[model samples]
Target: MDHEKVNILLVDDQPAKLLAYEVILKDLGENLVIASSGREALEVLLKTEIAVILVDVCMPELDGFELAAMIREHPRFQKTAMIFISAIQVSDIDRLRGYEMGAVDYVPVPVVPEVLRAKIKVFAELYRKTRELERLNQELEDRVRARTAELENSTAKLRESEQRRSMAIAAGKMGSWDWDWITGDWMWDEGQYRILGVSPESFEVNPANVQALLHPDDVDQLRKAIAEFNSGTRSYETEFRIVRPDGEVRWCVGTAAATVDHSSRVVRVSGVTVDITERKRAEEQQNLLAREVDHRAKNALALAQSIVRLTRADEVKAYVNAVEGRINALARVHTILSLSSWQGAELSKLIDEELAPYSPSGQIRLAGPEVQLLPTTAQTLALALHELFTNSAKYGALSTRSGRLMIGWQVDDELLTLTWEETGGPLVRTPKSRGFGTRSLLASVESQLGGQAKFDWRAEGLLCRLEVPLTRKPAATAPSKFDAAAAAELQRASG
Candidate 1:
């Protein structure tokens, strides 16, 4: 707690001699530690900060020279001054040995208090100055660390700005150019060189050089836009085409702003160009798809109208039901084709939908490859399958608990051959007269699908075989959906 007191340690084996040393150093006005032996002195040194230590030459264990050597070995005591006292006459060799052991001076038994006080005062002052120097050095180091952190933060912010600018240019597919209108000098970034398919060394800096690569049709419009920009009438915004060095044509949209002098005269122009060829192509495709959808919708409506006309019933309800079923069949096929982007419909899927009412039944079995049918064939076949399923559910294989049906198909070149057989049901025979459903089924296969169908009546059941063309092209036919057989069949059914 006493900041002004410097610790001075005195070591002696005799209590009387320790008393004598203490009385002499009492006038120094410092904290004094007295140890009876060398061992006691080391214990005091561990707990206290000593400016100086005085030791006696004669002791029982660990005499003055040995204690001084131990103290000098400690890094904390590197600056501690030691003094040795002896009652006997000392030789030159003994004094040299004592000094080598870190003793500052050797005093005889007749001690002088003034000389000892002066030596202790010098070392005490040195310790105070050393502590102050350490405090100043620490303060300087703290300031340097704070300044370095500030510089690092500033550098990080600059790097972040550069990264964001680079990302913006890359994400927008944009290239920048700056031109001095008066000097006809232009500077472009690497992105600009890539956009034009030309290296910087091969590119001319003049505006006319750029105009030469403009598409023939877009040259006039681009020139007018540039003229307006130069006159300060309008800010530059235009879509044009450019032919690159590799002879590839690309669509480009550009925006520019003029840097004017104090007099409002345009001196420099800077702008960005973005490649828009993919966007333009996508728009064109979208428009074409829209027009195609419109045309297909119109044709579908016309076809439905013709189907309704061709479809006849005994009364209003029957007519509505028949038309509704037929249209639903057509719609199902349309859905299948639409899902595949009008590529085709899968044969297995078409059959599964028509036979959904009889699903999970052991009586019906369908097997075939995943053959794809053209849209027209799929539509015609969907209607035909609907009628066949209806007839079987009413009077054929699907009508009895034990009835069984099997349908399978195989592809041969451009023809898909399908077989339908019924078993475990009442014997089927040729009908007395063909019904509307039967006639429609036949007409759909033979005319609409450009296919052939034959029905055989046997004692076991009825067997139907069909061969359909797998061509993607639609079957050519007149607009009329009515045929002589369908008309006759409708008349008979109505009666």
Candidate 2:
């Protein structure tokens, strides 16, 4: 697309032939350089770049073959297209030699004007494309270099600003202290006494006096750090607890660097101390909450997947009803747990939520101790209770206005056992098939809560019992324990 001028070199020993070659190619509208001999053509080539060369094979001295061979030796002309034109009919051997010497085409003259024009036109277009590509590539490199330099400048300025900020924080918030290695004299900035929770006149500024105020648990570690610094470690840093005169304990981190004399003797030790008890407490709380959230999220997702897998119905509406009911049951338990900061949920509160719908008819009654259930246990039991409630409302005792339901639980040692009883409705009969709700209730009790379940199909009503652990172990934090195979199966099923 670039309309840059391209050169076509024409070489011949005869003036008449050169004139005729010029006349044939002038209509192409490109630069045409003419030379009387091969030597003159080589001289012209040395001064300017050309796209194609048309040379006479029978030129005086420096023949076409010899010139082409010489041109091929130059790195710049390696890809330049060359065509050899001979006045007399050339033999096959001469034509082969011209090709071996880098000739792209050979023509016997009386040359065909159209053939020469087409060949020169192809090379001229190729040269123009090559130049355009080179220009684009150079521009891309320049942009990359400029952007890289800009990033480096930004990074350097950021590092400078960070250094200044760190210096300012150290000066403003920390207590600077120094000790002389030779005289054993101690120095304290006004901030150091405030950090120690003592008036300047009340305490001596000496290593022994300071060590006396350190908590017993931290004294040995602090002493070791000081010993290491005095023995040529060049620096000291350690965190320790100190007890003030009022018996209040505070956590402090101390840092010191040693300066040595030219004679290789320690000269001075200097550094700062700052309180970080609040930061450490905050970090601990954050880690605990993070672990709790991760555990709850994973368990909730697994529960949903299980519910979807276990629920079965012939119609879409039936399946949707079953899944939504179970999810709402889980949400009811979560609402109670969220109120308690996820510590534990009261058994009475959990029962009220699951049985709230049936309580208006006076058919549902709950009696239990003031037991606190862990978050996981509360969720699993809530789902199980909802399934039982649904069955009673449909086919069991609660279907009739006079029917009665009683739930009770008691704790013994490490286990808590619950009993559910029904009466005053149509006679209970053992069903031929166990539905999804029955299986899900049993599975939630046994597998998720690490509990056991039993059912009795008495003629008066249906009776059920469940036993679960009271204190559940906290969830693990490491990701390696997250079962990848189970997650993959869940993903496949969802897909």
Candidate 3:
């Protein structure tokens, strides 16, 4: 049988090294993923399943050994193969440490392409075989279970009374029941009693007793199904809920058939009941996830719409640039939130990413404690920061080579206070009137986030302060009608 391809991850800070590995592994016909740093490798591992990981031994932040240890810590990747690539001669102690950290093998510097390819191919094939074996084992187990069930059913049909009852005990979650209309008699096997959460000694096998165990809402449904069966229906299937003796409500599916005499009149009914509570719970969880995705998608579209409708510029190019910049900021926050499973995003990371374009100049500094912001808060704050950065780049501190910007924040009593101060720039003067950029920044913090924003036009540059509540409830997915009205008023004021 042909096996499906597996994934192989290559980690190195050097782009050249990653390219060389890619070239060597191309013939393996496996999915090859490259990460330029340990953090990037972790991110890839979060979203992809890898059979083999080839990591450089001397990368900064997180080396091969550290990465191996972290990967091994996760239950899903515990058995994944890790190979360390070292440029220099590794000491015996270093090799030992690597092995302890879950490294399966080591390739020295100036690797032979053929040797590297061979090693990766072996591991990739092994991973595929292992997965195939697991699948086959599961199939064999399923077939065995099906065969056993068939044999037990056949035995139940061939035998009567005591022998049939013995077979029902071995059917696990399934239980057998029989009812005779002529004698008004009902029979339940040991498994039936177990399913009802009762004992034969305490509970009698009678119609009224069984009806009492059925959930109130499902009683009418079961009655309707019985009525249909009595009207010449040979076999019928139905799902219902039963409230056990211990007050636990369990979902069950029953398959039943009618037995008739020569006159074509129903004489008896027999059926099997199986617990289906776990399946129902799983379906509920899936529905919840789908709703969450829908909610997030609507929120994203609404934010995009607001950006387009509210943005103002004099020239067409300037308008497109402004809209694209705001949209990109929204996209960046979305990426950050997705990486975290949409739970939230770190405040420091959001700021760093928004200001990354000017980071290389070494004039921007960020100081703050680790703070996580909700998705709505992060999205609005990202747009506000983008506007601030754009204005600074065009005419503020960032417009000059000698200028410096400091971003600092502190949290106290469930509130975060952040300050953005600029120095060493051209002389600053307060604007004669509010523009769209200023209005947008204020609206993002005040209207959308329910936060506070204060700006002071100092002689040196702009100094802004922001205060946000950390314990606020999540905002609505789309902006409210009031937000639109406010946007219109702001636009008129700016004009």
Candidate 4:
């Protein structure tokens, strides 16, 4: 809004262009300084705290490119970016020369007012923001110094006050422990003894004492968090468990942050602790409660969906008909697996089941991870797998016998992934609209199984990838999905 603003520098040899820019930017409230010649611009910058510079390349005595090179020679102005504005069409070679001369960008003559305003506005706003941030950072550093000085002046007095008056308070609140970071010696205030239900006279305060009282299961996590603190890796917030001599276990949470010296070595760390036994108990039961809620909600959804399918059996509306179509589609998946007595059905069996019903020739084939699934899981995978097979048969690579199909499965850790590939088919393109079949496939396989389904339609062929969790209990050719023996059999197979 004022001539003394620091965010922008506007330069143009033509009086008309400079006047036009001033008019356009008048209401912008951004810094604006005009230069009729490159020499005039360089003279203005000798004293101004110029955040940016715009130089016209077609000036009379010295062009924008020459002026930029001169500015680059000055260390103070090395990063003061220059934008070249000129009427003459700049070639690649000319642009390269401009860049070499420290020109940050080039804008042609007869620039659109809106585009110019937007561009300049962005650079001006960024310059002002950068100035504001630098001021804030300086203020923050000053405040931190003042605070640190106060802490240094009062540490001894504060320590004495805590030792005299805080023994009982800490015992009721949390155990008090302090460590000499340099010497690795530790001291536990009398409150520590009460927190652990130990007699102070019988206990020797050391890091080992702290470890001995912690529950074995929580030791590793606490140790890691503390390790990060010691190494100055990050601020410390750690949770642990303590079991007293009376065999009563309680949860505890500790926080610590290291203060570093000038050379960056940690000089000291201090923080507080809180007894969190009740909080930990709630956390332990959270998963069970969540699962119960999810099970009930899912059962309700399935019932509603099933009812809708039955109720809309005779409806002709496209969307209502979609519900009925999904039910029949799921039934088809069941039919294929049922044919095999629910034993691990062949991948080819699934492909043929879905595509054979639509295409004249069942040119389906299978490859990779020749394995069977639990019957329940089978219906889910088969339905999704079938959708891909059907899509290929009609609108994908599987439409022609010349098109090939590749199907495979793999298991690693507890994850099972299936891949489907089709080659020698039609060109790949995105779908215009997703159909009921797509919805059913996604719902049956991914939504129900808590897994992911990915589709990649490459020019070469269509690729489908499905990943699900597999049990470690071994792979089985067992009869029913719900049978424990079946899970055991699969575990054995996996091994």
Candidate 5:
């Protein structure tokens, strides 16, 4: 609705006619431009934003129709309003032609100043209104684009927020629920369904169905917690077991707050449930480990006491050495079991520890497959091996640099058979009387460990064979001919 004066171009073949048209439009308060020919009018239009172009119908080469056709061909001027001014009266056909060529109206020659000014005024006003409508449309389009962009940005932010919320819920292993206690209506989130090991499509959601998933023993606990809430408790927490569809039981911890009526009747409950199965399992394992540690401690102390009571020595130094040596053997086995989390100790490692102090490298050769012995078996075997190693160092193969001792073991039919052979040592002879080392070794292998031990005092050196059950059970203690043949084969293999 701008009231600013718009440009009006007046074209004629004669300068006088152009001036006349200009004089007619001058009173309309518009900026009137004069062009003496059609070409001159096009030149004016190229340089100016003409609201109305008044062209001479008959001109030298490019007339009104030609100029209008050329102007309409240009994209910028396609909608421009044009009017044709003619000196002679034109035919209806010529007028139709002028209208088709983009002319808005026609002005006759020898025009009435009033008529010419009125026509120019109407067309110029129309041009101004059309420009205003185009400007308004452009502004509306800009606003729509800006609003669309803002809405897209807001939608993107909402989607991102939802993704982060879902991730947080999953990471915490938690799910939320809302229950209408009055109507028995319930709503569970995705996490709730997942924790219960059911899907919305597969499971009916109701109080009875949900209760069916609970462990029978824990159902009373859950009901008691709810009863407490109904009796004016603001909130309650409970842990229970869930029997999943796959027959696996899982632990869940839930905390809920209830809204009650004026009479303290429960109206609604809302809460979150978390999967605590792994945490509960870790706690159970820790308790079992504690109990096992206590048992092992008591047994080790009792065994140490027995060793101190049974150990005998004529001299105080010898008694101290014997007791210390036996206790040291127990301590070494204890350390190995502790390192393995009280599971077992490696057989090869246990033998190495017992003989490392007495046997030099290459003089003592140990040949055995890797074997893991139970804690009790490891402790017993460590004591027996310590006794044998001590006796050998004092009087047998380990006492001389040229002596060689070979220890080997094999597992067959769940029984471990080990052999110890000595060579290149002083001549051997049977003991006149049994020493504490020999007696302790025999008792440890035969009675406490439920195994058998055989000693052969050969002319060259002592050869010993021990048989123990891997199951930690007592095996037959009677000697067999197969044992004699195995011992002879071992001696031949050593030579």
Candidate 6:
């Protein structure tokens, strides 16, 4: 206990009594308030809490007896213990009066200061203990609240887990099983009975009954996978067909892993079986797509080759490299399309990625608003733009070291326009080829983009123009569409 913090009140009319009490309690290191009258003591009590009060019984106006009586009357001062102080001896009636006024002890004056100080010490220690108990109770309450919060979080997680289990069993068409070796008990998650087309009450889970539903042709592999499971030789994995009594055969992927006993023998197994008929159909479709894409890519290369052969000048390796480079650019676009399962490519992302080689230090400038096109629109535009860029590099404005290329686009109410202009090369000239690049570039862009094109061979440069319709039909807003942040980052990097 901090004795310095305890307050002692001395209510006496005599100045000498007040001084003596202060001197004794000063050595006890407690705060002391001396009240010269009963009224002063009541004022002191209202502002501060005193652990103990020493009252002088004999006084002129409102004496110690009256003060003690008033202290006992108020609920605010009920816990204060009063020890009566007096010089005169009291009669039986006065002693009875002191008891009625809440006096526990009396000290005859001149007061023994040590006795008074010792009595004050007892009450101060009790105050300290009471405060400690309150603090402990508050801490216990906080801990209980924290524990309750943790339990609520755990319960919510358990409910979410049960919900997830129920949803997967409902949606995934899976069957589950569990076995206990020691107790010889079997349990199945709800999905297990559903996939087997059996009710929970109807499922007889013995090994032989479970095997009855398997197709006859798959018996050997099923037996092998199960044998490995029972002997602990390997993890279980097998694909088998199940023929229902109605002659419907469904494919399933069965897998299990063993739990071992103390002797290192296989004691139990737990696993799931999933119906894979739909997945198998999807795989077949994927194989067909792969073959189709391969055929298309080869045909594109062959067509480019025919264009190069028909347009070639004798013994010029530069022309050959040019032909192959154009084909390779188209192939790169095809590769990106394949990653999307040939669904489509984003028009803007396709342009930026394909034009990167020509922009070396990103000296070429490009910016536009935005546009979206179907997969066919994307391929046609990619091939057409590739042809225009190749020609500019070889014979038009971009042929010289200081040449600059600027590409831009805009959209108005009913029209979209794209322009490609080059500067600082040798003066432009007409292309000699009526071959694939020239003919294909014109036809594809005009017909496919719902656009027209014009080529100008100027003295200083070459310029090409495009106009496409803006009233495009709505498309599904696939979330896999190009992320704008990533596109802007690429622009900043290239710029």
- Number of the top-ranking candidate, with lDDT as the measure: 3
Candidate 1 matches the true fold with a TM-score of: 0.60
Q: What is the Cα-based lDDT of residue 44 in candidate 6?
A: 93
lDDT of each: 0.81, 0.82, 0.87, 0.68, 0.83, 0.72
Give all candidate RMSDs, comma-separated: 15.1, 16.3, 24.3, 24.6, 20.0, 13.2
**Number of clashes in every candidate structure?**
0, 0, 0, 8, 0, 1
Ranking by lDDT: 3, 5, 2, 1, 6, 4
Please give, for residues 153-231, the per-residue lDDT of candidate 1 as tens digits.
9999999988876875766457899988688789998777777777878877576888888888999976796689666
**Candidate 4 lDDT tens digits, 1-495:** 343366567777889888887887776776688878877887888978887787788877887778888989999889776778878899999999999999878788777778766777666667777778888999999999989988986997788878855754554557666666787776665556676778877877677877888899987976797678666674778777789888998777887677787988876666666677777789778987787556534543453353244232234685465444445555665676667755555655655565555564534455555555655566556556655765677777778767777767777876878788888877777665444445445554544566777877687887888887654332212223212322343344346
TM-score of predicted structure 2 = 0.48
- Model 1's number of clashes is 0
Q: Which pairs, if any, clash in model 4? A: 397-425, 473-491, 474-490, 474-491, 474-492, 475-490, 475-491, 476-490
Over the stretch 1-495, how does candidate 3's per-residue lDDT look in tens digits? 455889999999999999999999998888899999999999999999899999999999988878888999999999999999999999999999999999989999899999999999889988988998999999999999999999998888778766655655564456889989689798887777887888989998887988999999999977887789778888899899999989999888999888999998988999898877888999898899999998889888887887888888899999999999999999999999999998999999899889887663788988989999988888888888888898898888899899999999999998889999999888999988777878877876776677889999999899999998878863546476426745765967757
Between candidates 3 and 4, the TM-score winner: 3
| TM-score, one value per model | 0.60, 0.48, 0.62, 0.31, 0.58, 0.47
Worst 10 residues of 2 by lDDT: 474-483
Quick one: RMSD of model 2? 16.3
Q: Which residue pairs in candidate 5 have backbone atoms (N, alpha carbon, C) closer than 3 angstroms, thus clashing?
A: none
Record all residue pairs in model 3 with backbone atoms less than 3 Å apart, i.e. clashing: none
lDDT per residue (tens digit) for residues 1-495 in model 5: 348889988877888877777777777888988888777777888899998888888888888899999999989899888878888889999999999999988878778899878888888889888889989999999999999999999999999988876875776468999999888889998899998989999898997898899988898977887778767888989888999989899999999999888987889999999888899999999999898777788778766866786677999999999999999999999999999988889999999889877747799998989888888888878988888888888899888898899999999887889898998888899976667677667766776667789999997989999998888642212223223333343344345
lDDT of 1 at 379: 72
Cα lDDT tens digits for candidate 2, 404-485: 9999999999798999999988988987656767766665666566678899989899999999888765231222222332
Better lDDT candidate (1, 4): 1
